[model samples]
Target: MNETAVTAASTAPAWLAAARAHANRPTLRMRMPFVVDGEDVGSVETVVMDRIVEHLPGGHRLFFHDAAWHLQSANGNATQAMNTLAQAMRELGLNGPWRNEQLVVCNEDGKRIGMIERGLVRPLAIATCAVHLIGTAPDGRMWVQQRAFNKANNPGMWDTLMGGMVSAADSLEQALERETWEEAGLRIADLQSLRHGGHVDFQQPAEEENNAGYMRERIDWFSAVVPAHIEPANQDGEVERFELWTTAVVHDHLARGEFTPEAALLLADYFGW
Candidate 1:
């Protein structure tokens, strides 16, 4: 390999690497408006245009209004509105049992603004909370997992050892503990300190994988060291395998755009890059 390759592998920051991976990915510019009791809250993309049109009262195509897209509604019940939209997506084959989890909704500042069904949150461009845990072995190797090929989003991509969206009812720490046990089969208390390593706020327009209009997320990052004697096995089938990689190896994958953008961000933060 040339010096450029070596330097790129060694020096690239996680955020920059993730940005580069998404730099070439296509974004859907058009946003279908989401309104609640006349208050425009968010927008969805064209992927679910048919479903929205069908369920909307008048079957009106989304139109631009006040610099945002919107659908007409007579009612203002948030729960009913969310349930109706979620059902639409489900019938259209966009969401299912596993992907249709509950997620915490928040504003840009990361406050507990509201709650929504996870499957509809993305399309509506609602901000959601996610937790990522970085597991490190005593000898300095990072534990990473490959997502199962059948996952709804970012399938077949490399990801942090354990990560999941936080439900509306779960706190960040609680979500971390549950996700850790589910994804890696490790009880939180069995590991070393689950240190708070800061966070990453990611807001990007919808890409191809996001049939939902966009992805706006606030991720709480954590790191822990796993003893060599302890092995991580996947309880949920979302992960295919787990392996230990050096910092350099991780960076190389980042350069190659192998890790999911969210995973890249967590790993980058973990490496202090």
Candidate 2:
């Protein structure tokens, strides 16, 4: 890689980290009419984020992390506040930097209207970090199994080669490496080449509570094509079963709803048709 690419890549997280620092504070301001109680107030500049939460009497609550005059915010545009703070959290969670983006709310009439933040929420995806890896000479291929009948969500559905969750204190690569080692007995560096199948957020709507009760995470998808000469094996109980399948057979299973929706979509594209 050239020096420019290296420098840009190295500083990417720092930019996001900076954004997160300001995200919890009111460092951004823009004027837009706020829709409240069925009325569009003229050019109201609302606070999109603050680290504090202001509790109102009754079940009503306002996250003060993004602040503004109390009256204007009672029924203000929360889309911006929520999205920006979430973005900040995504960076903060990884101890990274922040970069400014549209922080969009939603798109309408070919125009984007919302806050100054990324306009989307990603699911906190949990999957096996990796499937195949180095070991004894490759014996055909290996089927990576995510312990069937999980105590949560899907109990016994086979998923793609790699999967995992992004913890509040871990970077994407760190989480992937840790999960791969714990679940599959392989380190991320062990596999030089990995492919991202895709990911899903799987979040629910917010409720009237202390926090929104929803976790947000943008899953970095992946796949590892280990040397055929090295066979991969299951290490922990998280994997209940293992079997080798040819790319064709895997394609067939993908056609039969056998993988995660995002993974299935990616696998479909991988198989081309």
Best by TM-score: 1
lDDT of 2 by residue, 177-226 (tens): 76677666666666644554444332222121122222222345555655
Alpha carbon lDDT of each predicted model: 0.70, 0.38
lDDT of 1 by residue, 1-273 (tens): 212223434465535854745633434576655654445556665556655555544333344466555544335445544556567666676643335567754434455434567777766777678899888887777899999998877889999999998887788999999999999999888887568888888777655453555776778988888888998999989999999987678778977889988887666656655
Candidate 2, residue 117: Cα displacement in angstroms equals 23
How large is the C-alpha RMSD of every model relative to the true structure? 5.4, 15.2
Clashes of 1: 1
Q: How close is every model to the real structure, measured as TM-score?
A: 0.79, 0.43
Q: Per-prediction count of colliding residue pairs?
A: 1, 31
C-alpha positional error of residue 108 in candidate 2 after TM-score superposition, expressed in Å: 17
